[model samples]
Target: MSFSPDRSQASEAAPVTGSAPGSASGAFAIATQGLSKRFGNRTAVDGLTIGIPAGTIAGFVGPNGAGKTTTIRLLLGLVRPNAGSATILGHPLTASPSYLPRVGALIEAPAFYPSLSGRTNLEVLARLGGYPTSRVSELLEVVELSDRARDRVGTYSLGMKQRLGVAMALLPDPDLLILDEPANGLDPLGIIGIRDLLRRVREQGKTILLSSHLLGELEQVTDWLIMLHQGKALTCGSTRDLLAQRGELVVEAGDAMQLDLVARIVSEADYVVTREDRTLHIACPATFAETLNRQAREAGATNLTIRVKEASLEQLFLALVKGDRS
Candidate 1:
């Protein structure tokens, strides 16, 4: 998948050589420098510098109240910046030309005319917005709403409304799609549907900036991630490089009770136990896995499985924000 960005007089796609990549894709679709926002005495975004690459599924993830919404609002020109500058697709965001048609956004839960049918609403918007009438049906099909195109939006379930909102975003045939918590109202299957649809958009050269709290699910679909903590960028990088928590291997043999004994015996292994039905997982330094394996063997254990399980993005996040020493 690839997204080609318009070339600016001054390049916004250049890498921050002093900083790590916020996304895996080569060129940036959105860039910010020293962007900050303050609401009276409370600072919502503080010196945020983010780079979202073209056509990549970049996860802007953080705990609740970490300024994700505020940052998105600023990028969309809904809120003025208190400092720094931001650009989208090679143009200063504040100086945006008549190029908004090239972008689509679903910020928060999307709104629609409750009394209008889905197709009618899209048709109305299409007519008023100068888009070709032929686009409505195509976008309806894309969002899998063709079958219910005539249903009133007010009668739609939350998941159904979300799909319809995405349909509306697609109606404009945008190059960049920005979604804030797009999966907020979706069911599990609906979430999968949205993820796959976004991937398809990437394949067609469209970039996506996705903000979500569903970390476990997003990790499966996103190529890169940016985590914010207390209104500041904590870490941002490719999924594999940023979240790989490597640790020492703790090998345990025998049934569940022996595993329990191993737990007591190896209490000082410098790792916490991750328990499964019949398995135990622990994180440790690379040096301790071998020693732990040998010690388990000496403790009268015949059955053993010993290997390192790398950390998930959730674990890495906790470690970074809450570890005794990060």
Candidate 2:
């Protein structure tokens, strides 16, 4: 895996991974150039080039077996890319695993000794990882586990355990945090807790790459998106670009003769209409959906159903994957 951070020299970063001097607009906190991974006859993640800007959240989304996990592993240097390279903060990812200190990752489900207290467990990991003891309290509070610090980790609920994993990742005060399904299997409160914690981390100018199968949850947190389908990057860009849809109104009436009359009134005013399923699929501002619904009644059109077909992330994903297959 070839990973370079946005920074100049990665070693300059404190205990963990170093920060890139120039901002993400300059080099991008996470850069992957043609990154790919393969397993014999099967290709898990193919030729992926993506960039995650610092201080923002980038959602890596896909369904089961979409290779989102493989990509995350490659970025963390746990698995080497077969074809391309990636860098974190300008430092080559495969060059040194120690550079990971600058990064905190919640990969897979993390576990601790069943008998260890949450606080002691963190203290042990923190000391072993070379992070200051001060980080333990800070992270426990961040994950909302401070109140249960003295309890045995095994006694904690699944939600608490997951939160503790997140706390461990945050121990080094990493600049780039990678979380894969951080909200999995949590209650509404736990999900909201993770969401709020990520927001706080982002506010501190930390960059986060959050991966999840829950599109709705990600839609709530990310400013950008890198959608993966069948191990390839299907679409990547600002969320606004993906969500924006454009078109016009086409009204359909059971009586074609009557509909033609209405079309002519607007056609003379420089408008065109097309008919679909005996209903007109028009090109018009979505704001006018209600207006058209009301206008069709006065215009002598009956049984008018205003169905707005706007493109959404889910829709776009389907189109891209289907397009690829075809």
Global lDDT of each model?
0.73, 0.72
Off by over 4 Å in 2: 1-27, 245-311, 324-326
Cand. 2 Cα-lDDT: 0.72
Worst 10 residues of 1 by lDDT: 1-10
lDDT score at residue 209, model 2, on the 0-100 scale: 92
TM-score of each: 0.75, 0.74
Q: Which 10-residue window of candidate 2 scores lowest in summed lDDT?
A: 9-18
The TM-score of candidate 2 is 0.74
lDDT of 1: 0.73
**Which candidate ranks first by TM-score, i.e. highest?**
1
Candidate 2 per-residue C-alpha lDDT over 70-93 given as tens digits, one digit per residue, 9 for 90 to 100: 998998888888898777876777
lDDT of 1 at 164: 82
Model 1, which residues run further than 4 Å from truth?
1-26, 245-306, 323-326
**Candidate 2 lDDT for residue 6:** 20
